[model samples]
Target chain A: MAVVTSRRGRRTAAPYAFLAPAVLLFSLFILLPVGYTAYLSLRKVQVKGLGLGRGARSEVFAGLENYQRAIADSQLWSGALRVLLYGLLLLPIMLGLALLFALLLDRPRVGLRRFSRISIFMPYAVPAVIASMLWGFLYLPAMSPLNYVLDKLGLPEPNLLSPGSVLFSIVNIAVWGGVGFNMIILYTSLRAISPEIYESARIDGCSELQIALRIKIPLLIPAIVMTTVFSLIVTVQVFSEPLTVRSLTTSVTSTWTPLMKVYRDAFAADDLYSAAATSILLAAITLVLSFGFLRFVQRRAFGEDR
Target chain B: MTSTPARRPRPAFLPTAILLIGAVYCLLPVAWVVAASTKAGSTLFTSFTFAPSGSFFDNMGDLSDYGGGIYWRWMINTALYAGLGAALSAGLSGLSGYTLAKYRFTGRSVIFNVLLAGVLVPGIVLAIPQYLMLAKVGLTNTYWSVLLPSIVSPYGIYLARIYAAAAVPDTVVEAARVDGASEFRIFRTVALPMMVPGMITVFLVQFVAIWNNFLLPFIMLADDKKFPVTLGLYTLLNRGATEPALYSLVITGALLSMIPLVAVFLALQRYWRVDLLSGAVKA
Candidate 1:
């Protein structure tokens, strides 16, 4: 009985022993930081007499004041609206191309399937910084092959980096980098479908396009929802691409995106309190958007909780 | 097998054309970078895009000579960060995921749910407070600031949990236990081997993620010596604004930085399509 009890005790502690490191790391990094952000967001700085020395400045609690300020900040609202615009422009076009390419690749007897798949998915390996930089130069009128070809054709050249068109240029860079990854995801899911289903559909006199439209697209909704949510979260952040492009042109501002605004407020403006508030706001919006989207899609598509 | 005839279908023209167009759109930038990296600084803007030049080695030499070869330092730093960070992350994820999947323990679902919640939090929210917290401890600019945050990947652990549940069987563990194997020993010898393929997928995914991470390193490290390739190239591009000559170097550096990743991607091509949630690859 003593031996059996000892063995049972050891078994009980085994999982915690294995999980110790992950739990510790998660607490230190994820849990602590989020709690600290919430704490900082509720606090404001108080300046004492003369405001000149170490103890002269101190943190004081200001309930919801920072949130109020964040709500009223025109720059942040504008940044949010701009990101909304960017997402509106980016999601449909990028996901459209991804779905198109994925369907084409999954087509029967498709030529150059391997080459096309590899070439299309290759950009997933390139970092956003590099992708933006590469496309930034390509958008340069003097160095652009597009402009050169237009010149030869006696057509007017478009200035891709100009303020009026820089957003479109950014969109192009994003599409170039993102379409391949999304295509691969969609294609992988497409490949998961049993071929027997397709064969039966074909035997029923359905064309390939009709099968894709009727069967494949309908079955791909869950994957499409997932990709859409992930892309939304990423697109809202919108940091590296625009940050990289800002070096090449003046169109992208220091606070081009909400995340960039958080950076500016935290480091440049030395406003950690407000930055913390903005960070919390952005995170709240992200969570709401993602979970809201997931719930809506799940209810509509599956009629049950995932 | 069914007794249906295996007839060869005719090649589809329209589908192939659309796929080819996508291939071109995706490959055009990579092709441009390969060509642009070879041009001399003076003619970088003047030369026709996609025209290869003889200054390939010269541009590389200039990149090598720039700032006492800090580009190589950035490369090593990136490799170290990605390599070591991903290794440690994979190990932790494997242990925790295996334990979570196999053991019936108190507070298990709560813990897993909390960790999954970490995945939904925007990185900016974490990055800002992490920077401040690190600063409070006087470790903001250290290698740890970046590597520590990267180590606890929720997504990796999630994948690992799914893999362990699928790959590691209870009967094998029961057999090992009956043989009087210690828990850790049973895990190391009996279960870990089965989890290796899944762990490799986790390792590769985390590796690329850490390598391609820009915001964390950008926010944390101010020292040029410690900057990863992404941040380093970004700064070089910023400087290129003042001196157009450095644009060629940025171009060269970008091209050089992609080689290791592209090589790894090609070598491990089979693992790229592993579905993290299901831990299955139809291929």
Candidate 2:
């Protein structure tokens, strides 16, 4: 009996053993890099004459200098503000459209539901760089259909890549690429709702819109909150769209977004210390914002259980 | 009781129309790309925007012949990266998620929370640090630079955990154990088959994530030969702004890049059971 019990104990340990690879990989790749970034954020280089040889430029421990520099950098601040503006333009519009499409698909008698869903969701497959490239060309005054129509009607053409219009251009690309996936997520959650709830509401003479507003949307709060948080997180990391757009327009400077600024500092300006500090600062701000947002949503949406 | 039923409220036409309008807005850029790819270089700017010419095939041929088939090479590299990376990611996520879900192990919550924290660490914040670390090991600009990082997906593990908890029953695992089967044997033979659909979902999600990835590949690789399609197209577009002649090739390349992914998405449409909140709730 002791031998059999020992054998059982040995067998049960296998799952944990199998899991070791994933945990090890996560530590080495994810945690170590993050910690290394934090560490690098606190250090800088001390240069000697000409700043040109290996030993001439020695590593020095600079405490908070990089952080102070990052805080004072107007370019970085403007980039963050630009992303905020872009998010302001993007989040409500994208989530609103996603919820609207989801509710529409849930309603009966909608013509061509499958076709529209597939067509709308198709863009999510395209990468942001490619999507921006496609839209960038379409936004060109010479190639755009809108411009063509305006010209035919003898009307003025709008420049999408103009300095004032560039933020909206970037936001529009994000909304186009994002709305469909969020729609599918919300739609899937909508489908998970038991039909009995809606049937009883119908029996009570509630209209479809009433049912949707009071029942469907309320029940979809969890999904909505999840999608919103993810959208916010992704919006904070906006890099590829503006980067691709920058290639086509001079108005999009290298420091158009915080991440873009970090890239430029690290790779273009060769200021790794400043870039590391800026990245760590961005990560801290994102953590505080997201956690704060999550707390607010949980209190308001999920109440005590969450 | 036999009387005609009272009239029901008609569906809200305004909101539905507004939603469809939004859908059109979402689809407009894609439609424009299709139309733009068909125009010749001379006609691209001169012709009416919606008019189709017969230059798509010619542009593709020219793009293929440029720099001895560099565009095709990008496509192949993208496929390899996304395909292999997703496969390995799915395997690791499956194993880890299964263990977390089924076993009553110590430090489970600690381990799981640590992994979940990774989901919140935005990719951009990690990219610069990851690049610097890779530079130390002389691994930058290599395939490993991209592939190594791509294989560890916290979100994938999260999804797989939810799937394992919901899909795999404890009773079956107990039964396999009672029959003298090893834990690994039971997982391989019993749990894995039950988890196939879930694993496929994880694989598709990871594949799309990896394929659509730009910043990582952009930072890690500098060699044009190793560039993925997205980076390669960006460089082409950058050059096109100056040369103007490369415009048609850029358009053609963009169109071609959409085909493989669109095909994969359509084929996997039925399997994408995206229960975003349910996954978190289950955890």
Q: Each candidate's DockQ score against the native complex?
A: 0.57, 0.49
What docking tier does model 1 reach? medium
TM-score of each: 0.94, 0.93
Residue-wise C-alpha lDDT for candidate 2, range B1-283, written one tens digit per residue = 1232346334446655765676687677777777878888888889987778888888888899988999999999999899999999999998888887787656666787688778889887778878888999999999999999999899888778778888889999888888988788988999998888778878888998998889899999999999999889888888887889898898889989999988987787676556633343221
> How many clashing pairs per prediction, in order?
0, 0
The local distance difference test score of each candidate is: 0.86, 0.83
Pairing residues by index, what is the TM-score of model 1? 0.94
Candidate 1 residues lying further than 4 Å off, grouped into runs, are A1-7, A292-306, B1-9, B271-273, B277-283
> Could you tell me how far off, in angstroms, the CA of residue B265 lies in candidate 2 after the best superposition?
1.2
Candidate 1 C-alpha lDDT tens digits along A33-143:
999999999999999999997999999999999999999999999889888988999999999999999888877878888899989988888989999999999998988
lDDT of 1 by residue, B64-136 (tens): 9999999999999999999899999999899888887788777776777778677788888888888888999
lDDT accuracy of residue B94 in candidate 1: 90
Mark the 10 consecutive residues where model 2 chain B has the least summed lDDT.
Answer: B1-10
Clashes of 1: 0
In model 1, residue pairs whose N, Cα or C atoms come closer than 3 Å (at least 3 residues apart or on different chains), thus clashing, are none
